[model samples]
Target: MIQQLLINEIDLHVQAILQESGVERPSTLKILTEHPAHLEHGDYSSNIAMQLAKIVRRAPLQIAQDLQARMEKNGRVQGLFRKVEAVQPGFLNFYLAWDTWAQRAEQAAQSLGGIGKNTKVLIEHTSINPNKAAHVGHLRNSCIGDSLSRMLAHAGYEVEVHNYIDDLGNQLADTVVGILHTRTEESFDRFGDFCWETYAKINQAYKSQPELAEQRAVVLHALESGKSNLAWMGNLVAERIVREQLEEMKQFGIQYDVLVWESSIVNAGFWDTTFELLSQTDMFHKVADGKLAGCWVLKNREDEAVAELDNAEHQGDKVLVRSNGILTYTAKDIAYHLWKFGLLSNDFVYKKWGAGLWSTSSQGSKKKIGHADMVINVIDHRQQYPQEMVKLALQVLGYEEAASQLKHVSYGVVSLSPDTAAGLGIAISDGKSSYAMSGRQGIGIKVADLLDHMESVIEAKRSKKTGISSRTIAAASIRYYLLKYQLQTEVILDLEQATEVTGNTGVYLLYAYSRANSILDKAKKDARVLHLEPDFNVSLLEEQEYPLLRHIAYWPETLAAATQQLAPSLICHYAFELAALFNHFYSACPVLKGSESSIRHRLWITQIYKQTLQQALELLGMPTPNRL
Candidate 1:
């Protein structure tokens, strides 16, 4: 808000000068986005003179001198700048009054709004496939999705998050076949585990007898037909695994406002409209001859290059509808996206299925939440081409409005650690296997098991702390671990690094917060709180107080940056920096026995700092424990 006021007032002065000069393109209202390392010039600096130099046909320094003369002539030069220096680069540096920074620092600590006044936005994430156990790779996707959603919401947007479930795919069919081949009876409770085993077994089986490829083809055909036994089983398997995965996501506080089911496209007849639209546009055609005869296809956008090849014999189209008259997964996805943005001129009759477990709104509440204005698919980067094709198909079918809004938040894969001794290497029957984490393979680590194990380790660490309770440590530790890294960066998942209460980990932050809380709790009963007054002089803040004040001053800017960038790592980084600064302040400075009344009052204000930091950390899903 201070920056806003400064920019607004300064802009008014510049505009008035430009009006008087009758000059256009004077670079008025220029922003000085200088980094702090350039503070040798000023906190804020601008090259407005350089911008106007060409217009005036004079040196930048001459232009700056004229601008300064005009401001003095208008009698608007008093009490603004501490000094103005013109550097060789034609940059004019303005040193603000020192008290300005003091006021800004105080405002940061006490301001009610961390999120600036910004436009409403809807952010979607974590649209994991509902056909298998959640893996580290899926963890990357969900983490990025949820963190970005939270960041946008914090930045003053009415963010509505969605998670789509691709419940009716060939992979789901394979799981069903696995269950049918392995299980004696249908069991919804064990369906997830059953699918997991089936996916791996079926894949391995296919490797030995390539004829099983035919079985997979049959399963795919059955899925598209809708009434096949495999289709029915696929539904059951998808529903069951969705339940299990939802429960897993619950531990990490990931949730969705809308549940867009891929299967619902068929049930709701959205695909029929999609096909009709494509056919009307001539975007799709029925093949007349060659290997893909009797199929409907779309010219693969990439095949135009093959057409230019000198000796290319037969690079063909991507089959939208296969020889058996079933649509490919890509075809169905196009319809699904069209329906998501309400561009199909149709809508699905949604049913309240279970309270989807992966949703925060579903937690401690029985009712289901539905309907979204926007949809985002948090899929892997490998699907970029397919998702792009889906968007193209929509545009070609005259759904340009919806196509414009469709978002595919593609994320990189969570690769396996080359080190064999990685954290609790994926569970396998024969040996510890990383392959279990693959949805296609269906052998993988369950999120619940991982959380339970982490919770146990954190609890044990808390017990070792002399006075801290088990619950406090566990909550703090889990929340910290989830947010320690930037979402885009792959977490190496070193157990020791994640579990350590030392270093840049969340536990260290919790301890810092706890130290502050402990100090204030005891101070409240003593004369410190009794004699505290609101007239605390900020100038009395000394030594470590400077860094504490500086860090606290950065909260608003840091928060705004995070929200704008849709990255929570900015906040994570700030939390650690602030915590580290406060820890140093706590060690070196004595709050209760300061030298002067001003010092005492300033020390008390650090309590406000502690409270604010604690609140911000919680927003990042990090905990601030009251005791170490």
Candidate 2:
């Protein structure tokens, strides 16, 4: 609120000066304000004078002086800024008045949430093949998806989250064939882990025995048919693995609104409906007399028409169906997005999975879901091609605006350090700093195992167990570690660094929050420390306290930026910086032992800091512990 007021006052004065000099003001004379790095640079600085130098044909310093003269006489500017200085080469610096800062502390009227009040945003993520245990890469996807859900909902958007389950994929078909052919070599507690090892063995056998590879294709056909006993076995295995994965996600506080099974879309003939609609468009074609003959495909772009359309690879076109009548992954994806944006006349059957949770079924009652203004898919960077194919299909069908609203949030995959890989039982024979994780090869850490390992390491470092559980700290550590890096950055998972409490990990932020709460709690006990009077002197706040106060009031702007970018790492960055500022303020200023006004104002700063950090933590899907 204070920032915008400063910007508006400066802009108004700039216009008056432009009019007085008989110069037409430019419509794009934007006023940009940012926090000065040091207190000596004043509270906020802008270069409006430099922006107007060319328009007025005057020196920047002279124009800045004129702007300062007009702003000093304005009553609004005088109330908010103690002085407005025109620096060399044209810079406007505004030092916030003491009364304005005090008013901000007493009652801050800054909020930019609820901007998306009536819109609906649908997010699809964590669509792991339901044939094995989830790896750390899957955990990273879930964290990003769940945190985005929490933030968009907090921003007052009707958010619907979906977890697409590919039960009919080749991965599940491979697992089913393995289960039927091989006997149990060893006893196992969890079914997913057994499937994990068996999957690798089946792939190895397929290479040695060509007949087994042909049998794998037959199993895939049966799974897609959804009728035979083999298909039933596939379904049973997929449901069990999905349940186990959800249990692992619950450890990190991630939940979804809907579970969309690919089988449901296939069985209900939803894709058939979409296929009929696509056949009427010019972009959809049946290739003839070439390598891509006997296939239905979509052109890359309308303008990229070639003499021979059969060469799809050369033109970047995508074949939706093969000669043997099998739909590709991108084909199914296009149909699902059509349903998501309410372009399809048909809808899926829904069944209640749990409280406030629903799943798509072959046959069930109806419920309102999946009609959204915007759709976001959180997939890894490797799937960029297929994701774009789906979006282009939407545009080809004449839904240009809806296609524009579709977004693909691509992120980098997760890898393991050499020591971490060796700890996971991978034989690290060659010297290497990092290793890529392969779930099929059984070389990656399972979600359950990772949580267990993190919890044990945290407990080992603690002198004793406190009231709070180590599970909470473990989740915080993992989520924050995965989210601190920018999107599209391949992260190398290191257990030791993630569990460190002194660094910029989630555990460090939790400790800072706990410290502030302890100070506030102790002050509340002793009624003599802070005078609960309505008014307190802002001049009593020391120089160090200003940074903390400024950050505490910036929660709204921080949230807005994170939400706009659909990046949770921004929130993590803000929380870490806020915690550091609070720590610095605590070391430099006295809260419990000072003048009554100073104590009151300092405690207010501490309380607001705790509240601001808590909001940021929750947005990143981290647990806020009062004590750690």
Candidate 3:
């Protein structure tokens, strides 16, 4: 809004100068500033004077001084600039009408469809393997994904959220092994917890016990053969485990439009269709090797070869179709992803699994559809090469349109502790401060456990807020704290630091908004009902109000940047900065204690801060507490 006024002022001044000089220079005037320091130096400053000086053989400072005088004398910028001065070194600075800065908050708050215009974006996140419980590593993924979806939709995007579940994998094989042979009475004490614990032990046992490994293979073979008893057990365990994780994540407000399960694809024969498609395109080649003969293979890309060097012995030319005729994990995943992008010529018969019983999203209260205009796959960066291969395979299959819209929103790994390595295990130093991603050791922190920890902290803090109901405060803090960080960076997630009610955290920002609301609620009892009108006198704003208004002015920029960059951290960063600015202003300004009309206007500015901060926190999926 400030920029628009400045541009208008510049254009009018340029036209006036041209008319006075009788010069027919058909050029548009431009505004330039190196930094905030330059903005403070002038309402709009230009380096164009120096360029013009070079062209006309005159001193730059003299040219700038003459232009400022001519523009002011013609009354082109009569009331716009309080003072126009040519400072040393040819810098023409204009101290804008102080009211100009003050009116920005009210103006921005009054814009048509002020918050989010009609826009739609689909975010896919937390696609953790369903064979294991979600951990702290998974926490980062959900936080980033959910926050992005919320912010975009808040910015008026019709957002769709998807959580892809890799329910069919080697881990599922291990899970079956655990269910059949490894589960103990103590392990089965909790339905899903036992499977999770047994899953880890089964995986670890696979290395030392060849008999256990063979048992796993037998179970896989039984599953492939569609043995009734074995299939029922596997399906039961997988379903139970998936439910536990989903229930846990729901507490954090991490949900999905559909649970796109890998097993669902298997049931729908998606792999068979994908294989046929690839075969028609001559994409899959027959392997000629010692163990891989008669298997279908995809030649290793050069990058894939380098990636395998770390796991050289186990990871080599992947066999999509084994000699024994079982489909590999990669093949199944390729098929599922192809189906997601509508590249697969096959479709699933998706029965309503009660999608409407939960949140109302884009796929609200309806059956599953076959295709989407775009597909976003949120997975860890470790599988970056594999995802790239998936894209390449899609392109090779002549689904160019689908391939182009396939986005792998791969985020960096979450390694919090110094001893942190990949997957779940005892760190030997911090002893597992952050959750890991393994199902073998059952050492990773469960999503339920993390939410319980956060809830307890939030509950305790909410208890201190005067007269605020426990439920409201608790609900607000939960969302606030969860989305306080960017997804790509590693958050150590020190429980104490995160739980704090003050400082540069989500809770602190919420407190600022809540405090402002509380103050305005009190003011509304006496002050006149003031609306943020276009003619709201900005010159009435004091120095303390300027910072708060400037922060409010940043919403459009923040939304644009957050979506364009595909990063929610930008919004998180902006929220904290805004809260900090408001807090600083709050401490210094006396809104409620002022004279009659002035106090009413001051309180109105406070209301603007309250609403702006509240909206921003909501976008981050955080709560705005009524108190504290």
Candidate 4:
């Protein structure tokens, strides 16, 4: 990348200056480069001079001048910079040689190789409990996770997407109990929704009747035991709901490489092996007294310290296995992660679940999976504590490398805007930022419902002459809406804002690409432009053209930055900025109607912009429609 090249050049000149001045070089030197607020300040600015002023015992302006002089004299920097100047307040400004940059930019815009290649990365996302229909919040998880997978795969990583199913958890147990008690007529068309309602009703029932909660224990035992009648029913319920969830995810172009079921880990003896490993260490121990007596708990040293320092009445150790010998969700998760890193002696049998997809099994064909170089779990911010404990468990088990490689890609939950809430017939207080969705309250938008609403809205807006289907446009809009936010920032789902065609929504991007295509199509129809390959002239481009070219040339760097920071929002920002630049260029520079040389160059720019937009959209898992 040009930025990296500039950084290297600056580093070399700084080291030479330090050595020549008889000053000991620091162990680490951080060179910071930023775009100047205005173009006249130069293309890139570095504050390294100010950073080194104290160490060199000289004025920053002098240091800046010295660095610029040395850089200007270096033969290697000739083609890279047009002028190396010392700006005010000790800033070293480097202006790019436009001709050289244009050449390199064109090459970068054309080339596709040299990024992440041959690296294996495993991403687990949308691991929703198989008891309820996927809601808007779950859609956020899948969208972010799927986008990350696409970004990594585009960068050349062998990405594996897994959706871990917690089939044996309390949620599923509650669902099973609800199914056994509720004898309502079956509506196969919306069985998943039916289960969602039943699950909510069961929770309400448990509140009024305390005894109904005991049924959860029975269902849990059956699930863990496996091979029993209730276990069969529970498995059947979970599998059906998971299929429904997958169908909902498919509308957004989300796919999975494997489905790791929690029950399979227990039935295949993976958890038993994990238990033995924990028993060998002090991480898991029996609580011999107090309310947690007879339970095998995982001791968290940090929590223990807090307990001692705060003199709290209640200890904070997590229970791994209860007095009745039933394991906690954390225990099963630890086992699952152990298998993920290939740390356990046991493995699950596998069976083909779908085309190019696999699922864990107790008695089926065996295939080698898991053992990823890195594992990213896409969960919500609420699970931060438990996620940390899982990492700590890996450390306690002497797999510090795997522990370090484990990443919890957590994000804030999604909520409805007040307008959306009112539209959904939900009550909201006046001064609230957003209304949180609650699955138990049956108060969240189902993915299927959201898709239906979006498709209807988009169809109403489309012209009769438009060729693209509303379903396609809706899918793109939903995925983009879910992903275009900072990880920690809460997303307020506003239907009107998300579906707008002229703003920073996905529809705007698709429209921009479509406009570029229309121009190219019109040019293709002209015989003079169709057969002509005019001489390329970089100087013919105007001020507005350089910004678009510069942004296009910086695509690889943007991808790398997003990957390094694990932030998909960066990619979103790049796409929005690129689209805005292309729009500006489209308005200011005539493409098909310009002189032959200008026409050819503008067409090349248009093609480059189209390719870049398509790449960014694909990385975000949004389809690039041919026309809007």
Candidate 5:
């Protein structure tokens, strides 16, 4: 907020300077403010003068000097900035009035509020198919989704998270068929783990026997029919497995508002209604005579280059329904999204799931829940095509606003490092960067197993003096590890690196917070630091202290940028940098043993750093351990 105020003052002075120079101010001037790479340049720098050079036909340095002179004469700028300087070439660097900024930053941190506009957001994530135990790849999706949800909620949005259950899909059908055929004497504590092994075995068996494929079809038909004994058995398996998966997710602090079953959409006739709606438009048509004969298809509206191909035979389209009259997953997704945006007339019957959660049912209490102003689907990168088709379907139905509001938050898959792969007994090929996980191959680390190992490793390193439990530490470590990377960056889980207590890990951040607490706790009892007031002299803060305070002041800006770009990694980067800066400051400056004024100022700065770090960690869904 303070940074924004400073930027506004600078923008006004730049505009005044342009008018005096007989240069028309550009209608669109982007007033950007960023911290200089080196602290000596200034606390904040703007390059608007450089951008104006081409327009005003002057050297950037000359423009920057003119703006700096005009800003110096402005009364408002004097209150916020110590000195405004025109650096080499074009940049306008503004040094903060340390006292004013310190007070403002302290106030801002204390009174931070939600940045949302009260618009409703529906985020559907962790929609793992309820056929197998959740793997490491699934953990990535859940961690990202849960963190984003927390960030949005912190920003004051009315957020509803839904976990879409693909219970009627082929994967579940295969698992069901396997359960029917396979006889096992092993006692299983969790049914989902049993299904995980059986699912892989069934796929492997189909590779050789080939006749097992027909059983999958039979099970699929039964699932679609929804009333036969086999269908009931499939539903039971899905229900049990989903419960197990939910338990695992609970360990990672993931929860959902609704459990939307694919079978509910089919049995509730929502797809039938969607079919009638699609029939009225030109978007869907039956291919009369081609490789896609009798299949109803939706025209591809995504890529214009592909759509404009003069050769009609080269045009690619999405199949909505097969020739056998079975609807594709894309069709069901379209129907589901229609319900999400409240475009369809049909609604689902809801039943209470958990304490405050809801689930769709064929026959239950009728409740309205799916309508949302914006829909964000946190699916993997592999679902780009189907996601696009879902959006295109909304556009085709004349809901351009809804189509624009539909966001597909796609992320890359998680893989394993070489050492980790070898530790897990998974062999990797010679020339690969990482070993990819596959649920069908049973080659991925199960989420429960990963948690167990992480807790064990953390427990071995944790000291008896610390009050934090191993489970809590492991959760924080893994959640932070999973979220620290950019969405497009392929994350290779290395157990050694993830559990380490140093260098940008979640454990390090937690330890930093705990260290601050220890310092403040000691300061409270020391006669030299106990009587310090909040009104400490800012002049005593050392060179290293300025950067820490500056970084703390940039919290709002960092959060705004991360929210605007829909990237949580920005927050991750900011937290790590803040922790590193605090660590450097701690090493260079003595807190309780300094002069009275110096100790007081340093203690306040440490407190601000701790509060800021705690907020950042919370945004990433990592709990701050009091002792680590």
Candidate 6:
């Protein structure tokens, strides 16, 4: 908020200077305001003069000089900035008044509201199949998705979350086939755990046993029938497995508002509605005679996902439905996305599920859920082609707006560091430093296992007398670890590094927050400082005090930038730097024990830091424990 203020004021006066000179301002002229590397240079600096040099037909330094001269006389600009200087190389620097910095510090708890402005966002994430337990890779997806949702909500967007359960997919069919073929007396407490093992074995067995692989097709056809015995079993398995996955997610603070089953989309005629619409376009049609004869195909975009489909152009393209009338995964996906954007004529029946969340049911009342301005799918980077195909389908069907709004927030899948992989009993080979998680081969760490491992380490380190829960601390550490990396970069998750209490880890930031709160609590109880509020002259603020306020003042823009970029790592970066700033100030400036005048401002700064960190923790989807 404070940063934008300077940009607007500078832009306003620059426009006036251009108008008076009769020099036409460039339509694309943008005044870029940024934090100066050194505080002595300025609080904020810009190079607007350089950008306007060619158009204004004058030397940049002279233009910058004229802009600075007008800025000093403007009442709004003068009150906020102590000095506006035009420097060498045509740079304009803004130095803020200490009171201006103090005022922004007072507005610490302020949020960036109305960013989305009635725009409804639908975030579809953690849509792992219900055939197995969620693994560490799935944890990354869920953490990023959950954090994105929280950030959007904090930015004042109407956000609805969906977890698309691929109930009728081949994975579920494989689980069913494995259940019948594998003979074991070992019963599973969590059905997801049972399916996890079964699904992995089923996949391994498929390479050598083609006869068993054929059963998947049989199971798939059977699942299409709503009343078959195998179908009934699959339904029972999918629901229970989804519940287990949801519970695991709950442990790490990830929950979806809608549990949309693929069966409902297929069974309830949503696909039929979408098929009819797609049939009218040349993009969707049945191949008359080719390798893909008698199969329905959707034209692949020349630029998207062609590598995933080895045959390009017209050869074996993406099949929507096979010759046997069985629908492909992409076909069901198209129908689901159409429904997601409210483009399909049909809709699902919604009913309240566990924990007051909604789920698509075969029989239930409708809810006002779909019709989003934006639909974001958080899928693996490997699915780039399929996601692009969805957008192509929208474009060919003439829904340009919806096509433009469709976003594929693809991230690199999670892998394990060599140490972590070995710990998970995965054989490290090829002299590789890391191993990618493969659920099909059962070579991955389950989410439950990772959390338990993290919690154990924290428990072993913490005092037994402390009331704070180790599990809460563990969750925060993992969430922060997953979020601290850039979205497109593959993560090599290490349990020891994530749970460590020092360095740039979440545990350290939590302790910093706790320390800030502890200092404030003591001040509140002290009779010497209790009655006196945080009132002081601007000159009383210390060396680290103004910088602390400066960082906190940049918070609104930080959230705004992160949201626009669809990156949660920016929030993590801000939180880590904020904690560092607070800790440095804490050591250099005493809060309750300082001179009375200085102590007042210190306490206020401490209080603001504590509150601000709490907000960052919430946005990151991490819990703010009373102590850590």
- Candidate RMSDs in Å, in order, are 5.9, 2.8, 6.2, 2.6, 2.9, 2.5
Candidate 6 local lDDT, 386-486, one digit each (tens): 88878888898898999999998889878888988888788777669778888788888888878898888888887652646888888888888888999
Model 4 compared with the native: what TM-score? Answer: 0.94
153-268 in candidate 2: lDDT tens per residue?
Answer: 88888999999999989899888888877566688779888988888777777777767777778889889888999889998999999989988888898999999999888887
How well does candidate 5 match the true structure, expressed as C-alpha RMSD?
2.9
Per-residue accuracy of model 1 over 1-628 as CA lDDT, tens digit each? 3344435544555566566667675434364434244446765556767776675566878766665555445433343445656677577665544444544455553342435344333455666666667765576677667776766565555566666777666677676666655443545445555566667787777777777677767776676567867777666777778777766666666666666676666666777888888888655778776666777776665563212222232333556786777777778877767755656755654445457323321123333232335445667667877777787787777667667766676655554433323343453344432222355554344555456566677776565566555444554455555555664555445445555667877677777787888777766667645556433454565655656664665576677676555566778888888888887887777766655575455555566678667766766765466666
Candidate 3 regions exceeding 4 Å error are: 1-39, 42-121, 183-190, 222-227, 280-284, 289-295, 299-319, 355-370, 399-401, 416-437, 461-482, 526-536
TM-score of 5: 0.94
The clash tally of candidate 5 reads 0
lDDT over C-alpha atoms for residue 210 of model 4: 84
* lDDT measured at residue 450 in model 6 versus the true structure, 0 to 100: 80
Better of 3 and 4 by lDDT: 4
Q: Single out the weakest 10-residue window by summed lDDT for candidate 1.
A: 305-314
Per candidate, the number of residue pairs that clash is: 2, 0, 11, 0, 0, 0
Show the lowest summed lDDT stretch of 10 residues, model 6: 304-313
Q: Which digits, one per residue and each the tens of the lDDT, describe model 3 over residues 1-628?
A: 4444544665565455556656665455455532134345754566656655554556879867877786677553645556767766887776666554454555553342334454334566877765656676677777777777765565555567766665546677788887666647573434666667778778777777768888777666665555568766766776677677777667666677666666666777888888888787544677665455677866554433312233343344556786778787778878977766566666765445455423212233434453566666667777776777677678778778877877777676654343434323355564555544444667655655555666677777564657445444444454455455555555654445545667776667767777787777666564344332213346467777666665666565555567656677677777788878877877887766655556667776777777777767776666566766
Tens-digit lDDT track of model 4 for 1-628: 7777788888998888788889998877698788786778887889999999988888999999988887877843747688888978999887777667656654553333346565578999999999988898899999999998987776677788999999889999999998877556756467789988888888888888889899999999898888699999999999999999998899899999999998788887877888889889876788787767788877887765212223232346777787888887788888889888888878888888888889998778877688787889989998887788788889988999999989999899999899888877787767687888876776778888888988998888877537578888888888888888999888988877866766788888888888888888887788878864533467797998878876886786787788777889999999999999999999999887768888888887898788888888888988777677
Which ranges in model 2 have alpha carbons more than 4 Å from their true place? 1-31, 69-80, 98-110, 302-315, 424-433, 530-536
TM-score for each prediction? 0.78, 0.93, 0.78, 0.94, 0.94, 0.94
lDDT value for model 2: 0.83
lDDT by candidate, in order shown:
0.61, 0.83, 0.63, 0.83, 0.83, 0.83
